[model samples]
Target: MSDIATVVDLLTDALGADAVDVDPASLASASHDTWPVSTKWARQDEHPYPADVVARARTEQDVVAVLRVADETGIPVTPRALGSSVTGQPLPTRGGIVLDVSGLVGPHSIDEIDMTVTAPAGTNGGELEDALNAAGWTMRFSPQSLYRSSVGGWLATLATGQFSSRYGGVEDLVVGYRVVLADGEIAELTASPRAAMGPDLRRLFLGSEGTLGVITQVTYKILPLPADQRLQAFRVPDVPAGLAIMREQAAAGLRPFLLRFYDTDEARHAMADPGFDGPVLFVGTEGEPAVAAAEMGVLTEIAARHGATTLGPEPAAAWMGRRFDFSTVEKRLDTPGGFAETIEVAHTWRHIHGLYTDVKAALAPLADEVLVHFSHVYPQGTSMYLILLGQVADDAAATARLEEIWATAMRVCLDHGAELSHHHGGGLARSPYSRRSLGSAHRVLRRLKHALDPDALLNPGKLGL
Candidate 1:
């Protein structure tokens, strides 16, 4: 009577026992995503929908084989990478199958002439960079999640990182890819230097969240490793001065790779151990040593103008060391009553001050402790990554706080006419607002998924599928 039984039979026929998971834990693991912080506080224990079977896909052939059966059987299939998505994007709510591609990371190439690199989807940013370093090259995309965030996961979820101000988002680094559609058909988007060829079909897969197809290979534009690198520290009096300093640097055309402005609260907590004076700024620049040194000087002058003081680079560097960790959140939640929440929002220079004010105000009364920080920025606007944690005595209370805070923050973003999300993909959590920002574009995405994956079997329950 269960659709899962039928879907399992179909998967067994296509992928064989080696690729399919029949174990209870494996299936359950595929059911939910890293959304417990949000779901738990809301009293949601039923989420993390476990799949009937999880296909540990190793190659494109395995992916195609599994998708073929899923399509024919009308089974819901969820594509999973590193399982690093914070939202419920990878959950198989319908519980059919999960295509785990973490093992599919393969070779990468460096075209010295074109300055591009082609790597398999399962490749991780850190691993890819290490490989490039061995070959005397570099993969420039560095998110805070580089340790666990796979290149495929990066593309699948449209992730971003600390270096985004210079390298831009994952979409900016991604140029071409090889995708396996829901129909089991594989299409390899070429790594052409440029393309006027049609609608550039590649863009569809850039941030589709696995609804359109399963990404198997990722080809990106690589750059030579910058020769010089340095991170300077500064303590600003307030948020306004920090923002003004960043804007001035951008205007002066001195773009620093590690340009971050943290809210006083987060800075205080981050540097709370000992010997920390106050709010500090970590300004890192990379390039020729002389040029980098000059840029640091420029940043120092700007910070001085903004009434900022130096906090020494040692503590700032230590903070950067532990910058990447989403798994620790669940551990904290498992204890009595702890919560972790983050919101990424971007707006034009004209709107950031007011936008930040409204967002903080919205969450003021609801949060136990709200700390804001600036991780990624652009010339046009900056991303405000807000982290709110509370002690609610149980998971349900924490979940309610997270959901309520998210609702309030989303409303703030909309009120200012800002983009719905800044990287981290639209994931399931942000899907409701997709229509508001994406408009008909969301419809087009669903149509594309339907056309490519007519059975609606791929990545079910993600991006509103």
Candidate 2:
């Protein structure tokens, strides 16, 4: 019998025939993620990422058993859920096993008193949010992929939602989680609002990208639904002026649930209102009516100081209504010889403009369109999202051009002293620059990876680990 068949037999014996899948279709589907390079390659009939088998784990015990067997057999296991990763984090680069936890759906419990929600890894983001909303509470974590992404996937990628400026990123929302280690041992990390613990172990796994273990369950902090919400839009002269307004508002302690600064091109595309031109800033404030009103007043003053033209709430409202729609990207990718991708990086106010200008200039020649926006604002800095779309003669040219864009963008970011990835965890696409991005800190990650996964069986070839 073949080695893979032998492994399948062992897995079937350990779990059950129903849980182990070796079908060609399943393997092919598990091969890649939403990464544009991977998608382009896939269109060319090149499946560089294919797992030998799949383990549809439905419980924590199933995860443990699969990990134990994979360890014993020295097989790489890539934990996946929802398959919404844009960085190929779930793609099994080495032929081994794809551990799918999408079926591990369990009852989610919300604690009104504690202001927290505990959910299984497979819990859908939208469902969880709806449940919280029905209970007069809000998850406050609204990623663009909320309807499609799983909780575990969010934690795995250390994602930041659209309203991160107010609620913070996934790391801030996640109070704790239960993870299964490489040796099939289950470990739970939990803490109160403030823990004087020696080291925050929860952080180690936050952005590990599943290179260390499998996150099985998560506990996230929630808040009462905002009593009032106010949306406002403004047109600024350019990115720098818009950024200054954002910085001033943030520094003055105005906490808006949503603060988005879109460049001219992105503004035109996002607003879809020809009357609104130039850089557009969409700001939303939500809370007690008094507090929301006060924040908006200060925000408007700041925008005016920066020479912004008030565009009313229509543009902001429009963006909010269609924020989750990814049809444009899907349509672009489906076009013949066309490809598109978004690279998000972060930097302090001091170097953000330089990073933006350099990266845009670097990528302009390689892409048909280069658009940018600033969101997830903070007092210290903000995250920039660079969108690139291009067409090539063939798959080979497309792949090459895509790689060039990534390489140039990363190089410019590094040169400008910006974070390589703001929210998306370093998967295969970003793995090459992981070490450079982390500098000496990369050694610390390596040590942790070695300590946790001695054999590197958990999601191999990711995060530069």
Candidate 3:
């Protein structure tokens, strides 16, 4: 039998025949992710890099069984959850086995005493959040894909949510992980109350992109649902002034669950404010009633000091109602000869302005229009999202244009001394630049990959591995 067949037989014996699928339809579906280039390829009736088999793992033991067979047979195995990653993080580049872990869900356990919630990696993020909400608790992580993404994807990609300014990213929320290594050995990296135990080993898998191991379970810190909440929008003179207001608020140790600043173009398009004439800032706070009020008051003062005009709560409220609506990009992607992409980069306050200007300028020629915003902020820096929409004449042009857009944006970010990606981990889209972006640290990553997955079979071709 061929290598693919041999691995398929082994996996079938280990996890049962029902768990393995070799149907052409399943294989085709497993080949690509939500990568924009893949959409173009699909339009041309192409299914490149189709996996030979898809193995659905219903439990941790099933994951171990799949990895064990792949390890013994040297078959490339890509772990996948909801496949919501737009950067092709879960694509089986080498056409081996697509290990489906979406079934390893729930039987979630929440420890109200410790303020943490543990769930199988495949648990849907929105479901988990809803459960927490019903219990008067929350993880405070709400990515745009909350309804579609899995917990594993969140940790795998180091994803951040709209509320990241206050609650922080997935890396900050995760307290532990249950992972299955490439060699089929299970490792539990959980410690409570912040231990100093040797470099925080759980981080090894937080953004590993499933190269080092498969995350089967996760434990995230939780918070009681806030008793009070407030949201307000302000019209700022320009991007710089808006950013200054955000920086000052963060520097003053105020944590707002919602903190976003949109450039004039993006504000006019994204917000419901029809009369938007300048850059806009959205601020939201949640906590005890008095505390939330105090924070909102400070934000208003800061905005006034920066020459911002209050637009009341309507704009902010409207945003909150549809914060997860991604139809703008989705609609474009659904149309023929059209595409939309969002690139996010970050830098300290000093370089952010220049970085934003340089990247936006470089990308303007590539896309029909470039809409910019600063959605996540920190005391020292903030993350900028560049949303661009464009149309091409054909599939070939769409493919080429997508590549050019990514290349131009990444080049400008690196040139301007900015992080290549703020929260979107290095997937296939960023793999080409991962080495240069990581620099000396790339060597360290290679060593770790070799040490854990010497054959380079786990999610091969990602993270420049």
The lDDT of each candidate is 0.76, 0.89, 0.89
Q: How many residue pairs clash in each candidate at the backbone level?
A: 13, 0, 0
lDDT string, candidate 2, 1-465, tens digits: 237777798889888999999888788888978888888877877888889999998889999999888888888899999988888899898879999999879799988889999999988899989988998999899999999999988988999999988889998899889999999999999898768778988887888888999999999999998999999999899989999998998899888999999999788787886565599999999999999999998899999999997889987898899989988777777777888998999999998998888888888999889999999899999999988888888778888888888888888888888999998778988999899889999999899999999988899888787
True-structure lDDT of candidate 2: 0.89
lDDT of 1: 0.76
How does each model score on TM-score? 0.92, 0.98, 0.98
Q: Candidate 2 at residue 266, lDDT?
A: 84
By lDDT rank, best first, the candidates go 3, 2, 1
Per-residue lDDT tens digits for candidate 3, residues 297-328, read 99899999999988888888988889888888
Write candidate 1's Cα lDDT for 1-465 as tens digits.
Answer: 237777777677776777777887676666656665534632444444656788888888988888887777777778888877777777776777788988787677789888888877887778888888887777667776787778888877778777877777777787788899888888987646668868876677877788888999888888888898888778888888888888888878777878778777778666655454455677888889999899888889989999998878875687677767555455666656677776777887788989888898888887676778776777777777777766776666677677787788888898888886777777777877877876677788778877887767677666656
Candidate 2, clashing residue pairs? Answer: none
Better of 1 and 3 by lDDT: 3
Error of 3 at 331 (Å): 0.9
In candidate 1, where is summed lDDT lowest over 10 consecutive residues? 38-47
> lDDT, candidate 1, residue 47?
47
